[model samples]
Target: MQDPRMEDELVIASSPTDDGISCWDLHTGAEHLRYKLCSSPPHGLASVAGRFLASSQLRNPKSSASGTILYWSWNKPQPEVKSFPAEAIKPLVSNSQGTYLAGGGVSGDIYFWEVATGKLLKKWHAHYRAITCLVFNDDQSLLISGAEDGCVRVWSLFLIFDEVRRAEAKHLFEYSFNEHSLRVTDVKTGYGGCNAIIVSASEDRTCKVWSLSRGNLLKNIVFPSIIDAISLDPGEHVFYAGGRDGKIYIAGLSAPGASNSSYGNHIIGSMSEHSKAITCLASSADGFLLVSGSEDGMIRVWDTRTRNITRIFRHTKGPINNVLVIRQLQNTSPRTSNHTLASPLRRHGAPLPSPLEKFVNSADENAYVKVFINPHTTSNQHLDSSYITVQTMENQIKELQQQGSSAAAEVDVERLKSEQQRSLQMIQQWKTMYDNLHQFCVDELLDPSHPGISSGQPM
Candidate 1:
């Protein structure tokens, strides 16, 4: 993908296909080596901060103690701590900045952990079935989770913590929906926390939105593909749902009491280029950039605005079941109260774009200016070096992809060379015309019938 990481390096995931986790670094499209986990059946994987990682796994349902959760340092080989009885086969996801992690169990319970302390801060019976998906808001006060029972729940962290601390916390809200045929596929909270809308994907081949405050199902969007995961732009305005069709779609949402977003509220763009399913998605604060990881072991970064691909999608060579974006030192100015801490985020999703580009940052909840440096560095030397590396690698990829294409559509080096020649010929013709026009404009006439007709089209 055309991401900064492709230059720095891509993250490659290689599990045993049953258990264990591995991270491979991409130097020139090939992995240098790997970071391995000793554990088996490691399903969920998430990047916490710049220094931490989190994961989880679900075992045979018939077994009582089959599910487990794990947390570790960025490059460390051992698990910091492992908890059992989690319900799903997916990895655990941390809060906005990876300081906190949340996972669901087969017992219909949700467990919360603080990464640094490895403390089981809270555990609650969240649903009646398997907790299939979960996500936290930017400020960590709100959480949205979905389950196999066709129920989506909104939780108030302030209340959960208050109840744990034995202090008085404001009353919280929760909402449930029974609108899908299969289990809840995935769930995500507001990216920038600019909105309170909770979005979820389901096996029913559709996505639904709920009001985190009132606990109401606001809209439902059906997709032609089975939505394996769903994500939102940082502005919360654009919602991206990805599925089996190997495409990610962008939709708008209606506020508290509007009609459908696609038909009534405010819904817009989408994208579908991957040949496989997209398991993970990440975006920057302004929602201008998006990074998506797929089952094909590719991670592509997109310019959501132009809807044109800008980068590579190879962070790994294995099925990347999960991905998260990490941020540090948030710079936000809050609107609610004082004492607002800037918490960075590891984004879970992104889609297409529109003209009225709005950002949905979870930090909007706390009002913090994200103090981040622009990632792009304009270096002529680096640019040349990067282009040369990319050209060589792309030649290899072209060979592979062409093999999969039909004969008429096949593209080989010879074809590229021929196309280059054609392009040069066109450039030469354009230069000749430009020269003729300039000479004609000053030299008066070239033909008997043609005077100073430089301000014109070709005869």
Candidate 2:
């Protein structure tokens, strides 16, 4: 036996009740660190390049200055930096290079900040409801945001930076997916950059895959219960969806359609041992283990090969909101910090190795600098070259416009416009009604014949 919990010696889990983080060695089931938190972070904690840890804390929900982001160095016991964003942000994600940090707010907005200075770089309205999850691609070129509005949108960092620098009025989103009918709980991007597939879990009891390159819906998988979280396989071949029914369903991405349904196509495997609903899930860096956190405050580590529970760690008597498996750094010495200065490397359309290969051999023991793959993989069927052309975009639009779908889309836009007008009219009518009621009350009060009160002054 290979000791089924995979390589989870550096795994960390956080509970809502404790306001503390617990790190454990999954193999031995021993505790490593029990760091106290100032406040409960919204979507758990994140580590930055093995140097420091970042958490978005919610001190008081009603206060204007309730939300604060705290940064702690690896060696220091206390937080090194504390910055109040003044918004109740729930989810936070950092880029691979550790230059930029993105947070999702309860007000359905996304805020981008520079790590070193803690400066607010950009803020935008992302969804109608609260944002639940945020994730960056391998190269940090794209940012995927999911919200309770059941919308998943992809944004280009390069384009965002350029637009901000130029102060352009027009905003551009790379892609927007509205396949989910309820709130989107989790969103994870697969290996490839532009050609990557985004798997989003929703409260609608479904998980959908959207193609980043083609900007289209590729697949929709229905689960028995609401899927709260999802983790992609290292090979990008399969994904694990944790549901409220206390089951982890293994859905396929590269599996054939016909064989997947009959010969266990998309739904390949499942693990159901938890007595409560699963709240969060995280896969090991090597893809050998799947860790799931449930409502019963139990964290179970499953062996992917054997499809069995290999280890279980009991957390606090609260829901486990976030679980992260950070790869331990080989050397303790810190690398030079870039802070908030973002110097993005230009994409030259170079192909990188697969995520599995990159994850296995990412750390460099001898070299001072760490090894990281950008994951700029592209498909031959849709993308023959690395660089996208104007003609290619036009062709894609034309292809999508086929079968009179463009007219249908136009109709949808018009319907939305009409709906907005109707809503405005309703508001105006309500305002008129309120004004009439106020005048009637004033008249009644000013009249001496009214029995409630006598007129004290001129109305």
TM-score of each: 0.58, 0.68
Per-residue lDDT of candidate 1, residues 376-397 (tens digit): 2223221112212223445566
lDDT of 2: 0.70
Residue 369 displacement in candidate 1 (angstroms): 32
Please give the lDDT score at residue 132 for candidate 2: 85
User: Where does candidate 2 stray beyond 4 Å?
Assistant: 1-9, 38-42, 61-65, 75-80, 164-170, 258-265, 333-459
lDDT of 2 by residue, 1-459 (tens): 325334324567776565566676655666654566635543647765434567777777676357776766443446656666647778888776555578888888888765543445567787888888999887678889998899999988766656454366354577889888998889999876778789998899888999998999998888778899899999988899988888888888877664444324477768889988888898877888889988787889999999988888877566787788875432222222322111111122222111111111122531222112233432222222323333344456566678667765775678699879879998999999999999998888777876555544444
Q: Find the number of clashing residue pairs for candidate 1.
A: 43
Per-candidate alpha-carbon RMSD to the true structure: 22.5, 22.6
